[model samples]
Target: MYKLNVLDKLSFIFIIIGAINWGLIGLFNLNIVGLVFSEPVNLIGRIVYILIGISGIDMVLFLFKMRKSFKE
Candidate 1:
């Protein structure tokens, strides 16, 4: 089994948050991230979005790592 480190855990959390935010947008036309941050453009919001994007990439890498571990 593959163990998740701190970064991996944090990334997973962010990914879940991102997924929930998207779901809300699709189901209820709500943008939680934008609502929490400033509309149009906000530096802090942009940073958060960037972090979420990075978290998604991290998750993809984590999947590959897990797959490799399983094969081993």
Candidate 2:
């Protein structure tokens, strides 16, 4: 298992935020990111979406695989 540390904490926080954003979209049919990012038709918003999606993919992968960087 991975040792808990600052980076771990920050990643978990981002995962939480990503989860909440998806929940809002599914339940309320709302897009907090779209509203916040505004002009999704442009470049910056696309980059933001890509980053969020990547983070989500990583979190999902981590859930099934216990991190093994922790040493004896």
Candidate 3:
């Protein structure tokens, strides 16, 4: 089993949120972030988007690190 630290857990949470948002958009044409934060293109919404992007990058790095560890 793999152990995840705080940062990994946070990234996973953000990623899951992003995925759900996308699913809503695809299935219902709804934008949850936009609804919660007002216009999805606005400042707060943009900040949330940026955080999600950073979380995705973190997850990618985590995957690489895990792959390397498993090979050792």
Candidate 4:
């Protein structure tokens, strides 16, 4: 079995949060992050979004690595 390191675990958590936020947005037209950082130009919200995006990319890479591990 493949064990996740610290960065992998953090990336997974962020990705899950991003997915939930998207679900809420689609279902109820709500944005949890925006509500939490309620500013017209919130730097922190932007940073959160950027981190989520990076986490998504990290997950894709992680998935590929896992796939390769399974095939070997």
Candidate 5:
């Protein structure tokens, strides 16, 4: 439970940041990854994007488990 709880928190934070970044990209044509890392194709930006994708998958797993618990 401790590990999962910590992971959930971390994943949530990542997801929030990813969502906000996407919103900026969509509404203002801002390239957060590009701006921060000096280029969107940089290794750091790629890693960030990968982690964001993983966090999203983790959040979905969390939600599925939560729903299962509620159904019990």
Candidate 6:
């Protein structure tokens, strides 16, 4: 089994949120983050999008580390 630290867990959660938001956009054309923070093009909403993107990057980097662990 793989162990995830706090940062990993948080990033995974954010990624999940982003996935769900995308699903909503595909199915209903809704934007959850924009709904929560106001306009999708606004600064706070952009920040949220950036954070989610960073979380995805973090997960990709973590996967490389995890692959090494799996081989050991």
Per-residue alpha-carbon lDDT of candidate 3 for residues 1-72, written as tens digits (9 for 90 to 100): 468999999999999999999999999999999999997479999999998999999999999989988988
Pairs with backbone N, CA or C atoms under 3 Å apart (clashes), candidate 3: none
Model 3: residues with Cα > 4 Å off, grouped in runs: none
lDDT score of residue 52 within candidate 1? 96
Q: Candidate 1: deviation at residue 72, Å? A: 1.2
Q: How far does residue 38 in candidate 1 sit from its true spot (Å)? A: 2.0
Candidate 1 TM-score versus the reference: 0.93
lDDT tens string, model 4, 1-72?
A: 578999899899999989999999999999999999885529999999999999999999999989999998
Q: How many collisions between residues are there in candidate 4?
A: 0
lDDT of 6: 0.91
Ranked by TM-score, the better of candidates 4 and 6 is 4
Q: Among these predicted structures, which one has the highest TM-score?
A: 1
How far is each candidate from the true structure, as Cα RMSD in Å? 0.9, 3.4, 1.5, 1.1, 2.3, 1.4
Candidate 5: regions farther than 4 A off: 1-4
- In angstroms, how far off is 55's CA in candidate 6? 0.4
Quote the lDDT for 56 in model 2: 71
Higher-scoring candidate on TM-score, 1 or 6? 1
| Candidate 5 lDDT by residue in tens digits, 1-72 | 224688889899999989999999999999787798876368988888898999999999998888878787
* Clash pairs for candidate 6: none
The clash count for each model shown is 0, 0, 0, 0, 0, 0
In candidate 5, where is summed lDDT lowest over 10 consecutive residues?
1-10
TM-score-based ranking: 1, 4, 3, 6, 5, 2
Select the stronger candidate by lDDT from 1 and 2.
1
For candidate 6, write residues 3-71 as lDDT tens digits.
Answer: 899989989999999999999999999999989998646898898899899999999989998998899
